[model samples]
Target: MAETSITSPHIMQIVGYKNTGKSTLIAALTRSLTFAGRKVAVIKHDGHDHFEMDHEGTDSYSFAQAGADAVVVMSEKRTALIERQAIPLEDMIKYLSRYDWILIEGYKQAPYPKLVMVREEKDLSLMETLQDAVGIVSWLEHDKSESMKDSEGLVRHSVHEAEDIARWLVSLECHEEKRRL
Candidate 1:
């Protein structure tokens, strides 16, 4: 994979095949980053053709079923908008640029700085095709050997080290901020 510049420094992606703990890692990162006083937003890619958000008996569900193009529900503390169409990732990122960190889950082919999850030896092949991979989160203990060095400056971390990974991501954000200054 060719080296790619970080176009959006606040964006970082966690990508891996199914059952590779990508969601778990992203959840951990969100909690840690939030506790550290950073505003974080997450965008997840669902490969499935359909996903359910509103329950069948809910008002939102009825509105959608009535062919409403968009349904937005708001309360004192939270708001959610469901559009009938798929929004492109770039547009979503632009809309969420106000957040201090946008930790994306999935979208493996995106050129953002990413931490690839490797569950086994075969999973390491993803590094060959993914662009701008900054690190690796491995599930297997011995998979951190030299054979895993698919790119220069790629750091390796165990799946258990969520706090360490969070710290690493925070440091990267700080470094990028400094570079921009």
Candidate 2:
């Protein structure tokens, strides 16, 4: 598979199968990173064929039904843009490149560094097939058992330790930044 080019200097992906807590981990990491004074942006891929961001009775929904290609809703506090199109992951990354960090929730095939979520021993098989896996966030009780041989050289963090995981991620980004310099 061809690697996805990442334009952002600081970006990481948290990827796993359904029910593996990728969303929860990303939320925690975003909170922790923002508290530490880092600007953070998040991009999540929805695997479903159809999803509705606006309710049927809402104005935005009405506009969409009226054949609007894009809808922009803005206020003093926040702004939302709904475009009727499929955006490539690389384009999204480039658009969000100004942030200090971008945490992506899926696109598992992308070549960016990722922390794979493992909820059971069977999930360990992912380690063997994925590229650029920097670490593992494990839900299994005994994450260090021999069953984890595939993750031997990668850092392991318990799923419950989001704060620690956030720290480790920041440190890894720092190390990579220095290496690039």
**Relative to the true structure, how large is the alpha-carbon lDDT of every model?**
0.85, 0.83
Which candidate number would show the highest lDDT if scored against the true structure? 1
Q: What tens-digit string does per-residue lDDT give for candidate 1 at 1-181? A: 2111245538889998889999999999999988887788999899885778888999999999999999999999999999989899999998887787899999988889999998988888888889998899998776345577646798889999999998887777657866776
Candidate 1: residue 140 Cα off by (Å): 1.5
Candidate 2 Cα outliers beyond 4 Å, as residue runs: 1-9, 150-152
Per-residue CA lDDT of model 2 for 34-83, tens digit only, reads 88777889999899848778889899999999999999999999998999
Give residue 102's lDDT in candidate 1 (0 to 100).
92
RMSD of 1: 4.9
Work out the TM-score per prediction: 0.91, 0.90
Per-residue lDDT value at 125 in model 2 = 78
